[model samples]
Structures are given as C-alpha cells and as structure tokens.
Target: MTSPAPTLLRPDGSNLRVLVVDDEQMLTDLLSMALRMEGWDVKTAGSGFEALQTAREFAPDAMVLDIMMPDLDGMAVLQRLRQSGDDVPVLFLTAKDAVTDRVAGLTAGGDDYVTKPFSLEEVVARLRGLMRRAGTAHAAGAEPILRVADLSLNEDSHEVERAGTEIELTATEFELLRYLMRNQRRVVSKAQILDRVWNYDFGGRSSVVELYISYLRKKIDAGHEPLIHTVRGVGYMIKAPQ
Candidate 1:
C-alpha cells in the first residue's frame, strides 16, 4: 500500500524542521534541495557526532539518518537521542536489504526506513509520512496522558514513565508502546503490530517486534517483574502483574 502524503504546511508558525544525516554529500544535497522546495528548514550532518550536535542546535521535527556511518552507526545515534529524551521522528537510510538490519534499525527507535539508492521523491514522501505520523502539523496542543499498570505515557509531553520512573523512548518505541497500551490486555499479533505501528505489514517476519520488545524490556522490564510477555507462536501482550 502507498504511504499517505505528509501534511505539508508553510514554513511559518508551525514550520517543520528536518535533519538529514548522511555520508554522501551528493545525496544529502539532493535531499536538502527537495525538502527546501517543500519549504522545510533542513540541516545536514555527515557523521554521527556531527548529527548529534546538529540535532541539539536544530531541534528538528524529524530526522533522516543513514544506517551505515563512521564512529557511531544510526542505531547508536538513535539510542543516544532517545536516552537524551529527544523524541524526534527518525527515518533510517540503509544500504543493506537484510531483514536483520531493518529489524535492528526499527527496534533501535527508527520511525521508518528507506533503502539506499532511493529516489529523492520517495525520500521526501517518506519524510512527510514520518511527520504526519508524528503529529507535527496537527494536534499541536495538549494531549491526554495514558497509563496501563506501572507504565504511563503523556501524549502531550511525549514522555513515558514506568513505576514512577521516567523512561525515554524513541518516536517508534513510543508509538509501539502506545499501541500496546491502547489494546491493553488484548493479545496483539505481530502482523497487527507491524501494520498499526510500522504502518506496513512486514508479512510474517515478527523479528522487528521481537527486537523492539527487547529494547522495551531493557528500559521498562529490567530489574522488575516482566509486564510484556510473548505468547509463543502467536504474538505479544502487555499486562498488569498477576
């Protein structure tokens, strides 16, 4: 299925800020050109450290990060960003088409992925998709907070807490957790999770979900009783301590 068009707005009042992180100067320039044509403020970083610095200064509404980079990879960069409580939406650019790579990127907090050698049009389209999903142009006001068991999520603040302790989640992890919390006790299948959370049905490859679950476990379930459970051969579920 085709992705939805981004809710593009003028670069005034609520103009979207985007950060493009890539090693390819030509591709980065092209992306910047296309995004600027759409009236977005864009920044470019050729390395992970530079990307982090740019992110701090630019505070982008969304980020386009390359998976393969020197010093620190996209996944590591994403982890650091999340750890710093930045929920900026991330779209990964990967050179490898391996499922493991895709799953790793998604689990590490990427909102989306576009394989390398992609069309500029497709990249712009996907960026818009991320922005739309992030509610950047819409719902700019306060949103309600939600909770299930010890986990709490503030939609307005984009902050998550577990057992009264603050937990940092990437845009993708937050979305995934929100989906689970929305369904609560319901057993959500991997297919369903991929469709709703990733906005793509990744067929039967549930490793993405599994990988994200591991990430969540490290953050939310570590040093405590497990709240998220795998339902062998079926799917996953989140529940209160029984």
Candidate 2:
C-alpha cells in the first residue's frame, strides 16, 4: 500500500487558481484535496476535452496535466494550447519514469513533470517552483541596453541587435529576452525569471516563458544560428554567438 500523500501549504497567502487533469478520478480527487489544503482554488477534469474547456472557463493560474490521459494526451493538449498562444504554466504527470519521457514532455512545451506514484508534496513543490519562476520573469525591471554576447537589447528603444543588425520585440517579448540577456550564460531557471521579471511568487505560470522564448526564436534565431540552449532538466541559457 502507498503511504499517505503529504499535505502542502499555499506559499502566497491567497487562494491560487489551479486545474488538475487526470482520467483517474481517485487520483484527481487526491491531488485536488492536497491543493485545497494549501488554500488553492482547485478544479479537476477527467479528460483532455474537459481539461481544455475547464481551462478556458477557470482561467487557472497553473495546470497539472496527466500525460497518459485517454482520448487526448497531455503533450497533445499542451501543443494545442501553445499553438493557440495560451501561456498558462503546466506540470505534467506521467506513469513512465524514463528520461525519454521527461525530455519529450519538456520538448513538447511542458514546464515540468511528476512521475506517477509521486508524493503529493513533490507535485506541489514542483508547481510552486514553476509558478515562482513565471512570476520572476515578469517582474524584471526596465533597464536600458541589456547586453549579452554580441547581442544587445536597448530597453529604452525596444531594439535588439546582433552584430549591428536591428531586431524588434514586443513589450513582453522584449522583457523576456532582456532578462535572459541580463543573466547571459547563467543557467537561469524559469523560476528565477518569473521572480525577477513577474514579481509574484509561487502563483504565476511558466508557459508564458516558453511562448516568449518561441517569439525570441522567430526574431532572434529563426534566420540566424541558434544561440539559446535548453539545458536538459535545468533551464534556459543565452550564450554568445559561436
């Protein structure tokens, strides 16, 4: 028999909105109970379709998705949401414990993953970490001219350039790229980004980080060689052009 899952306390004082998606009603209930104990406003869905619908209605701050759901897998749902430009942070739950599975989930746009038979405490901890990162990324200050490598970001002008060519960025996109550049080569976790940039802690979401990274890829790396390297199981890093 499995031991009782540990309880969790919500870190930010207010009730956070969270969506828990799993086909197993028992497991979903357990997860929801754990989150509620932390003072989160929790919602559960038993299928991919329901998860999406609930996500739209609930507008949750973060989501916990089971990767092996029936009808629609977590990766598929995540891809669809990302394609639609939803930036809600997602934590995947999977029965598979293989490294490949974890990599696949991250590559498919998941912020993090928890293996099945996991302690509820572990799940909550991961979610909190993801949310914290999301908060930091948005809370970063407005500093002019963030330089990393040959790349330069003029926050005052919202101009990005490498080797002297001009690059344009949206407001949010600019901040995201600037944060990465400011850290420059450091293995800055998504949580740190959220905390520094977004200002909230343990309540925001990480999907926004991925989406903005995608934006940066299009503007900064689509035509040029890749400069952003994803450190597997760590975070993201912006390095000098080599």
Candidate 3:
C-alpha cells in the first residue's frame, strides 16, 4: 500500500502559518488543504487585495502568490510589500513559463516559483525548503554555523562570509549555498539539488540549477581557489581548497 505523505512541522512543534493567494478559489482551497495536511496554519485569499490584507493580518511565515490577478498583480503586491519593508518569503505560482516572467518574479524578491498544474507534494516540499532555509523550521540548538574553506554561513543571522569578507545572498541563493555546504565534498546531482533546494522535481529546466551555480561561483568562488566543481556527466560538488 502507498504510504501517506509526511507532514512538515516547525521545529518548535508549533504551526507555521502560510498564506495562499490566487484569483481562483479552487486553487486556493486546494493549496490550503495541502498545506493544512502538513500541520501548517493555512489561510487563503482570492484576490491581490485580499492577499495583501490577509498577509498583514496573519503575518505568515511564507506565502504562495499567483502572478496574474485583476487590478493588482502579484508583482505589484510584492513591490508594495518590499516597499513597506515586509521581507516575508514568497513563492510565485503562475502558468506563465516565460523566462521574463520568472526573472521578473525573482527580481521582485520572490524566493521561489512554481508553475500551474504542479503537484501538491511538490508544493509542500517547496514550502518546507523555504521555511527551513529561512530558519523557521530549524529546531532549537541546531548547528547555527556552517563552513567550507573560508566560506561561513550563520543560519541565525542569515549571513554569509568568506575570508572575512561579507557576502550578500538572496534567500534562494543562500538556500542553494547552504545545501551545497552541508553536503560538501559530495557530488550532488541536479535532480537532487532540485529536490533539496527547491523542494520539488521541477520539470521546467535543469539549467536553472546551472544558472544558480554560476551565480554562486561568481560570489563564493571568485578570486579564490574554485571550491565548486562539475563532475563530467555527473553533477556538482563543493569542497575546501586542496
């Protein structure tokens, strides 16, 4: 018999609230049900306006937002949130698979993106990744510092530095780097990265991982002995300089 999916719980054994925003009531309901199954507190909004209101009231730990809506689009809502200094992590949910759309969402400070027709498990996994990387799901007394070579990450402070020089990272970038650093010296396949970092097996493109790897190399490996390496016909690995 197939086993039931496991629920994701916060480290403190309390519910982590999530706000699901979509113009489609069915989608919001479906997402709420999925999130609730994970023992998370789930709230739904059927419009951009409602999402904004609910987000403020609920103060969710993370949000799943739809890109298209009447009057106020997801981009505009996100812009408003950032403008007001609300740094809540958000995952964009949309049917638009265009590169520009994805770029726009990321540029607007979205932490992740999932296209329409996504699986419930994938969504749950992605949210779990976001929460864990954001320190929302980490249990008390967990290791707060991770280091490889001169690169160090402070999980509590959400800071990354190498060789005493501070490095700034987007939430997604930090999550990707954290995953790599945690498995340092182990070659992790792109599929594994997708599942671990994004919490989903994204069918969109493998280049997404390559793109982030390139981004990391620029920030983490620049002017240093290259710590990230590609295994021909395999995957990627991060290790200290020899």
Top model number, TM-score: 3
Q: Which digits, one per residue and each the tens of the lDDT, describe model 3 over residues 121-223? A: 8888778778877777653455779999888998767789999999999877998898898899999999998888877545757899999999999999999
> TM-scores of all models?
0.58, 0.54, 0.71
Q: Each model's C-alpha lDDT? A: 0.82, 0.75, 0.86
lDDT, candidate 2, 1-242, per-residue tens: 98543332223334568899999999999999988886678999999989988998987778999999889889889988899888888999989988788879888888787788889878876776555444422212334467766678764445689778988666556667867887788988888877655433434468777777788888888766788878877789998766
- Write model 1 residue lDDT over 1-242, tens digit each, in one string: 98544347523446689999999899899999999987788999999999999999999999999978987888889999999999998999979888788888888888788887788877776677577558564333424477877788875457888888999888778878877887878899989888777765576778998999899889989988888888888888888887
Clashes of each: 0, 22, 0
Query: Weakest 10 consecutive residues, lDDT, candidate 3?
Result: 4-13
In terms of lDDT, the poorest run of 10 residues in model 1 is: 135-144
Q: By TM-score, rank the candidates, best first.
A: 3, 1, 2
Tell me the deviation in Å of residue 231 in model 3: 3.4
